[model samples]
Target chain A: MDLSFVIFVEVLYGVASLVLISAGLAVVFGMMKVINLAHGEFMMMGGYATITAVGYGVNVFVAMLIIAPLVVGLIGLVVERLVIRHLYGRLIDTMLATWGLSLVFIGLATMIFGNTTTGISTPIPGFAFGGYQVNGYNFFIIIVSILLVITMYAILRGTRAGLIARGTMQHSDMASALGYSSDRIYMMTFFCGSALSGLAGAVLAPLVGLVPTSGGAYIAKAFITVIAGGPSLIAGLVSSATSFGLVSQFFTFTISPVIGEVALLIAAVILLRTMPKGITGRFFKGKL
Target chain B: MSRRASQDVTITLVVSAFLIWFLPLMISTYTLTVLVIYGMLGLSLGLIWGFGGILCFGQAAFFGLGAYTYAITAINIGESTLPMILAVLVPAVFAALLGAMMFYGRLTDVYLGVITLVVTLILFKFMNSTAGPQYAIGNARLGGFNGIPGFQTLNVPGDPSAYIWGDTYFYVCALALVIVFLLVTWLLRSSFGRIAVGIRENEVRMGLMGYNVAARKTMLFAIGAAIAGLAGALFANWGEIVTPNLFSLGQSAEIIIWCIVGGLGTRFGPIVGAAGLAYLKFMLGQQSMIDNTLIMGLILVLFVLFLPRGLVPAIETLLNSIIGHKKRKPKPHRMRRARHG
Candidate 1:
């Protein structure tokens, strides 16, 4: 019974983190349709930002939630103006350009942070649950993700700005015809997407040691999650993340993490095969 | 074939011939061989991405497969011939399987890129972790991150005594490069190439016109993979090591960079892109004032934004504007028609 409870939490934690890792990408690639290959790099920057801010004596929560996102979001904003703006409709071009940008970001990060893996000790220590001791950070992650989902839901479904963002994404020409500036909308959406990526990175930094190339690992998984999620934004992200997280973690606990990672990929491939339009594409139809 | 198309083919053949003769005196055998192999890698990607409009982000997956296949097979068999065939066949077969899944599944372009990249990562991660003794295939140990080394290198077919090395190896590889280039050129001009280009231009239209778009794409993808595999096989012989890094995202990204920077859609563009950029990178590595990544980033951004046609196409456009009124120059669409019409 205790083992099952611990397993449940582990699965939840997995789903939560996957959601967190892919949320920013969901916003960017899911809605904006800009394949931000440098997204993982942005997350890396976010991790660096949180670490730097924390070193400067900022509160960890503040560093992660506020400072990291702000820094990465600003970078995203600049990237939007400089690169993404030009290659909005051109899908393949954006992939190549952003891949270059990803390389640049990795190099820059390496120069600043050095190539070695650097990380902070987990703020929330391990606590006993029956025979097992769970890292309290897992709970924190779960809570943060729950909060994240709620916030995303509120912002996207409830707010006028969310409506505008959604409107612009669906049909920019139509949005422009309604006297809204698509450029500003795009920039702001990219900023939000970037900030979310940073937040994910910052939050997860303590869990995994941060290195210059740490982003590379996340890029594939985040992309898989976002792409497999399909079109219905929040619903797709949550649903796919849940399914994948459960599947991967179940395999991780049953076998090994290597097998787990492989399972996720295979699952993604299978997911994509059956539902080429993605899970949400077939099921959700129109729900945000 | 049209007169102009044949003329361009002849020019390519002549250029290759000149290079086979001229390159030996100008550059060292080592550099020449490396450049030739890199050019082959770039050329394959140039065909898939530039012509077929299939941007495979993880091309190094096939390259790595070829290298590992060659290195392992060479170690076990102790003969270079089977390993060489295995090198090309392994990647081609793998690509055929992968391409079938992707193309037949009706994957959109972005998903294709993502799925291919994931596969490469899967290989990289899988190989990186295989440090144990159990990872050995027959007599050849994977060696994990350290890679598989000390394999029998490429030699003259059927002769185990006389090894192909140094200038002889360079000449042989250069000849192979020329042959591969000419073969690709011929393929590009064939009926199959036209249909592939047509599908790239408009998949829906091609599908409507009774072409099995998916099968053609899969075959083209396999051909490109075979080319990449050939490059990988040469690379293994040149470097004498097959590391997991061959499947790395960095390696894959570099291949794409070569295709882009050199120019796309032109026969000579990838050769220029691969050779020129390889030299530039080698030069930059000597000093390294600014980061190479930064330089690469700026080049990619600049190219995409300012010069989308790449160096070769851009130069061709300039030549067309300046002194060439009668020159039936290669516009993308006309090149499309020239290849298959």
Candidate 2:
């Protein structure tokens, strides 16, 4: 394959991954008010679970499908119940509390897994696609992410639970008063968000090595995505993620990744300051 | 201040200072050096969080920045003291600029915390990468992961002294700590400090009252950065090395943990917190039996959940209770009487 084609493929992969992560973040933020700083930790948990399952002689694909989200979701539920549930509405408390929780989680992971980066065996053996030379495992992630996004979109737009979740996001007290249990919505939202993060982790495990501190790398980017996309709209998240990914990749190819990230962050900060409500607000101001 | 409160404050200061001065004499050089570093770290955290109410998790960024700056500048200038000053000044100015940008953008509290964290993480990554053009001061190239070493030593005022081998150096560190502590305390008691406190309590009200809340926060933050920079410069001199770990998230989190553990919003809480935690960590390291971090995490959880007000306030309350002093009570029905009148 040509150099330009390789760069194009890389950029596509980057954009796809960004979209998946940002969509997950949007869903979580739209439903639950929690910032979930440990969201990346959930991803790490999933990645670890995938690696562990592979080690246990399980079919890599099947193991990832079942183990990744399940382990991550379960951890997410426990975290919500134990720590995050108490931190609702209190911003500083939530940030600090989650930060402490992140530390504990990182420490525990390091103790259990040691400081080494763990690898996951690729699922589809030597499967490859086109002149782009795509790895089967990463291809699977891209496909699964697309499927998840579609499924989430359907559930959110079509279901009664989704309505209630959206209502809770709009106003917790009012939602409770109107007989929609905000606590239950919050729990469901937290679980789903965590599950998605885990799924992302599991899917990406084959593509990326899992280190104890890997989660810290993605967190800042995830936050920037959320802010840039605007927390309120799903489509806005999709657009923001794709654009950011493309921009970052383009910059990374031409210049440097570090410079790209800094540029992206500076742009995001400027955008956020100028448009606090985000791009979605321009059009959907009345409805949202 | 009340007579008893003043007396109690005086007693606490004298006792603590005496203990610190005597500690090095009794302990090993390594232990003494560690304690001094902890004291410096605590002073940094105290100035920022306690006075400004800015829960900065990125102090280690400045600390590390100062260390690298000092090391590099010292190598270039061929003088230890001037480089040390440059180290502190560079980071302080960087922090001041960053602070102005953040505060002026109206990012307060959590947002402020996130931006600082992101900045530190970027620095960490940038330093760790080592792929880009190397930053060179004279012939000294920042070796990235390997860090800068064999930099200039601390210059004592009177006698020509060899670097890194004496009780005298530690004594100088002690003196530096005292000066920093007094300087911070004085700053806290000034009008600027009062304005910072007002901003912390009710920034909106302060702004409405014509106080420039952003400027105040920026100034306080810069002061805190300067202190951390000073600590970092001293640290490079003591450790004789500088690494990217200074800019790591772990370092930042550790400082925040120290502040939280010591007691936020109190003058000496950070000192107590940093010293107590550092000593415990040292003991744990010496034993080599337990995971020090796991224990630290547990303590953090316990403190946040149970002792949210932290150790200093808890101690103060306990002391007050032990003294058998009746707590002053507000006059009952005052609101109702005022309404009736």
Candidate 3:
């Protein structure tokens, strides 16, 4: 393959990854007021689960299917009940508490797994599509992310649960007064957000090798995306992620990755200042 | 005069001065050095969070910036003291600029925290990645994963004293600590300090009173950054190494934890917090087999939930209770009966 062609393929993959992860985060943030600082940690947990499953002589794809989201979701539920539940309405306390929780989780993971990078075996060995040599595992991730997005959007907009969740987001007290169980909705939303983060981790584990500290890398970028896209708009987050990914990739190819990340962040900050409510906010200003 | 109401300001000053003068002789060099460094960091956080009510989670950015500035400039200039000054100045200026932008933009407390965090993270990533050939700075290589080393030591010109090591250096550090602490205390007691308190209490009221709340906040942030930068410079000179880890979220969280654990609004709370936590971590490190962080996390959770007022206030209340106070004199019986009727 030519050099330019390879770059194009790489850029496409980057854009796809950012969009998938950002969309998942947006859904969670929109529904639940909690900004999960340990979101990336959930992804890390999922990655570890995938690797562990593979190590146990399980079929890579099957192991990821069973282990990734389930383990991540379970951990998320526990975190919600034990720690995150105490953090609602209080932003600073929540941020500090979750940050400390992240550190503890990281320390535990480091102790158990040791400080080394581990890679999972590709789920579909020798899988290829046309001249583009697709990793069947990554393709599966993309498909799953797309399906998840579709399902989340449908559930958010078309179902009773979706309406209740939206009502809670708009006005928590009013939702409760209307006889809907806000607590249950909150729990479900937290579970779904964490599960999506886990799914991202499980799917990306094979693509990006797993390390104990790897989760820290994605967190700042995810935060930027969420803020720039406006935490309330899923479509805005998806678009922002795609744009950021493309910009990052283009800059990485032309200048350097480090410079690219810096540029993206600077741009994101500037954009945030200019458009505090994000693209969707700008477009739907009158109605929203 | 009421005995409890008597001012002991002179005695307090004399005692503090004596401690400042004699701390090196009283403690081991290691202990003295750690206390000085941690105390300085604690003061910085206290100024920012306690006075300004800005819960910054990324003072480590300024800390790392100061260290790097000192290290790089020292290497280039072939002198320690000048570079150290430059180090503190650079981070302070950077912080001032960032603060101005954030404050003027009208970002609230939470957004301010997020912006600082994002900036620090970006700096961390940039430094972490640019350690290779493309970003090398002379023989002091950025070294990506390895970090910069062999930083110059602070020097005093022509005193025939030579550069001190161990206890002597600890004495110098303690002296610096005393000076900075006094300066901070004075600042906090000044008119500007009262305005800062007013800003914290009701910024809208302060604004309506024409206090320029944003400018005050920005200035306070800059002052805090300068102090943090000073600590960073001292740390680099003491440790003789600078790394991207200094800018990490872990370091920032540690600073916030120190401030929270000590006492929020009290003068010595951060000092106590930093020293106590550092001592605990050091002791835990010695144990080797135990998971120290788990214990620390539990303590933090307990403190946040139960002892939210922090250790200093709790201690003060306990002391006040133990001292035994006189009961108030009863009101006139006739007046009391009339009031009741």
By DockQ, the best candidate is 1
lDDT of each residue in A130-204, candidate 2, tens digit only: 555655555565677678767877777789987777778878999999988788888888888888888877787
lDDT of 1 by residue, A148-251 (tens): 99999999889999999889988999999999999999899999999999999999999989999999979889999998999899999999999899899989
What are the runs in model 2 whose C-alpha is more than 4 Å off? A1-5, A22-28, A125-137, A272-288, B1-13, B131-134, B157-165, B286-290, B326-341
Better of 2 and 3 by lDDT: 3
> What is candidate 2's lDDT per residue for B1-341, written digit by digit as tens?
35755575577569758976778667876667657776778778777777677777689889898888888887876667777678778888998898888788876554566578777877887777653445665768777777888877786533325454467667767767777876776676668877877677667899999999888888888888887888888888788888888898778877877777887777778877887888888788876444566677667766766776678867876777787557663232110000000
DockQ pick, better of 1 and 2: 1
TM-score for candidate 2, please give it: 0.90
Itemize residue pairs with steric clashes in candidate 1. B262-B273
Which docking category, incorrect, acceptable, medium or high, applies to candidate 1? medium
Best by TM-score: 1
iRMSD, per candidate, in listed order:
5.4, 8.8, 11.3
Residue range with the least summed lDDT across 10 consecutive positions in model 1 chain B:
B332-341
How high is the TM-score of chain A in each model?
0.99, 0.89, 0.88
lDDT score, candidate 2: 0.73
